[model samples]
Target: MCSSSSSRTIPAALAIFLALLLHWSSAQLSPSFYDMTCPGLSDIVLDVVLQAQISDPRMPASLIRLHFHDCFVDGCDASVLLDNSDTIVSEKDAVPNAKSARGFDVIDAIKSAVEEACLGVVSCADILALAAEAALGRRDSTTANMSGANNLPGPVDTLAVLQSKFAAVGLDDTDLVTLSGKEP
Candidate 1:
């Protein structure tokens, strides 16, 4: 009799324990709750991160792949969000000091904002992908609006010509878009 009663009580106790643990750990939670559409906070942060890395060449290609995987596999569920787990972000390391740049600064600003709001909630992997996508989009849009190849980075402009302008903005053509999250 005692064994039977304890077995039934154990399940109930375990359920309550799990519920409380989930609640306590979720104190900070996130801006966008997980759902089918998009992970709101994660998406926004990733966008900012991709924008940040547009001009950075040192970033690894594998990191870029992970960004898309996170977004596409789960529609920005924030699961792809890897912590890169580094307490210290190396954003300041790769940039050159003398050059005049606009986009890198924007990227930095975005990173800062996310840190303020979500900090550990996001991962370096997601941030990198986000920054890349934003940079790519900006460059693409600029080219589309251009009149000709000879003009200021118009779509018709040669690939090399566009790169020069991208340097000014701290971005490149290849840095944009992830395979999955663009639509979601």
Candidate 2:
């Protein structure tokens, strides 16, 4: 029921193309992506995220989780950034995100800065991607997940369940182990 109603199935070829597009958008993103269009883009976004992290120590992890949730729901197209409207039911209101998702204000602040610098050139998707990357360097606390955290693996979950979760996203065992190794 949490799945987006707006999501539609496509032909195999179209699905492949969309997958490639998402991969290309992520793989091609670089710190220098805005060098020509907005020379200060990276600095601006980094500063804002840093400030946000200082104000709310959980901001970094929230930013990372927010990006992951956004990507999971809508292929990292920044659909999560959309506020609820008459015709739009925002992903932010999803059960996984109801109170867990954060850093929207930071994203908005960064978006404003990007707009002032490069205007229409920067996409919200790019902002989210950049902010998630910037958030990596910031410190985060090792906080416990609250009840009903449906989207993440449980601490005592078996290896099979963990592997299955990764497989659902097209990740192999290698990716699962590699990602698991990053956990504290």
Candidate 3:
């Protein structure tokens, strides 16, 4: 049997461990990550996004959503961009993504421009992050997590359910509201 003090200490220790883990994971992201390998990466991404936004005002938001979905399923690995294949089921076909997610064409254009500028130097996952205006060092995932994509929070989910889902991803109420673009 554990005493009250020990029980409290256990939770505190667990919280600290989780915080450290999150920090360690995000510490790899840097604004200058592609400075050497892909000097023109950001400019290429920005140009494509700007052109896309001109044609579709919602392109910016859609790119951000695409980044969020990709990250949520498998740590921003660009798995959301995959299509149905013999070895992969694809997150795009998930209910939460189908008919809602967009900006793939923009991403493809960005890839083309980036490749022309600096071939094989950038990863699609990093490109998605850049399109969302986030600078991060990310790698592409060869496999997609269909089950994880299916479990993403939906439009009609209750507040409690949303909270639970966000919490599972180490996000809180503030993150939930901010990401949802809603006011508390």
Candidate 4:
């Protein structure tokens, strides 16, 4: 009887530990994360995005899609922005992203502007997150995952497939509907 009670207590303690770890990890992201480091970060990103929108009406949607793709695969690390390198194959070359993923130039412009404002202080991953007005304080990943990119849901994916893909990423039916509502 004592052994059974101890086993249950052990599992409960482990579960609590795991829950706190996940919370702590996610709590690293804060909206004002770059406020002190990059004072005008959002303004800079917004200026570039607005400029890009003038030239291409689809720029905003493209950026949102880019952010979504990056997050879905690997938690918004900006691996999608990587180009072919000696050690990296780049998610840009993935089937879902090859032809459809775009607005790289705009990202480049934002990076340039941010660099000019605060050289080597801001990260590309953070820039991508800010441009999309999503989360913040994410660090860039050193490596890209082409297979993960390849598995991302495509435009032609069925409702069931989309739901499955979103579920795989810990998103629910409401998330599916909300994200699906965004148009490109």
lDDT of each: 0.35, 0.61, 0.79, 0.78
Model 3 worst lDDT run, 10 consecutive residues: 15-24
Question: Which candidate should be chosen as best, given TM-score against the real structure?
Answer: 3
Model 2 C-alpha lDDT per residue in residues 1-184, reported as the tens digit of each score: 1123212321332333333334425445455766787778788888998889677766755676677666544355677787766666666666667777788999999989888888987778778877776211111112222221354444566788877765666656755554454232
RMSD values, in order shown? 21.7, 13.2, 12.1, 14.4
Clashes of 3: 1
**lDDT (Cα, tens digit) per residue for candidate 3, span 22-58:** 4325778887999999887888888898888778766
Please list the residue runs of candidate 3 whose C-alpha ends up more than 4 Å from where it truly belongs after superposition.
1-25, 181-184
Mark the regions of model 4 whose C-alpha exceeds 4 Å error after superposition: 1-25, 181-184
Off by over 4 Å in 2: 1-27, 134-162, 178-184
Question: Model 2 TM-score?
Answer: 0.65
Model 4, 149: alpha-carbon shift in Å? Answer: 0.7
For model 4, residues 99-176, the per-residue Cα lDDT tens digits are 999989999999999999999998898898777776577899999999889889777888888888877778667666
Per-model TM against the reference: 0.24, 0.65, 0.82, 0.79
What digit string (tens of lDDT, one per residue) describes model 1 on residues 1-184?
2256655753454443333223223333332332223345556655654554565432323333333233222222223332222442221121221121124344346557767767555444334435433111100010111111112233344556556544443333432111111111
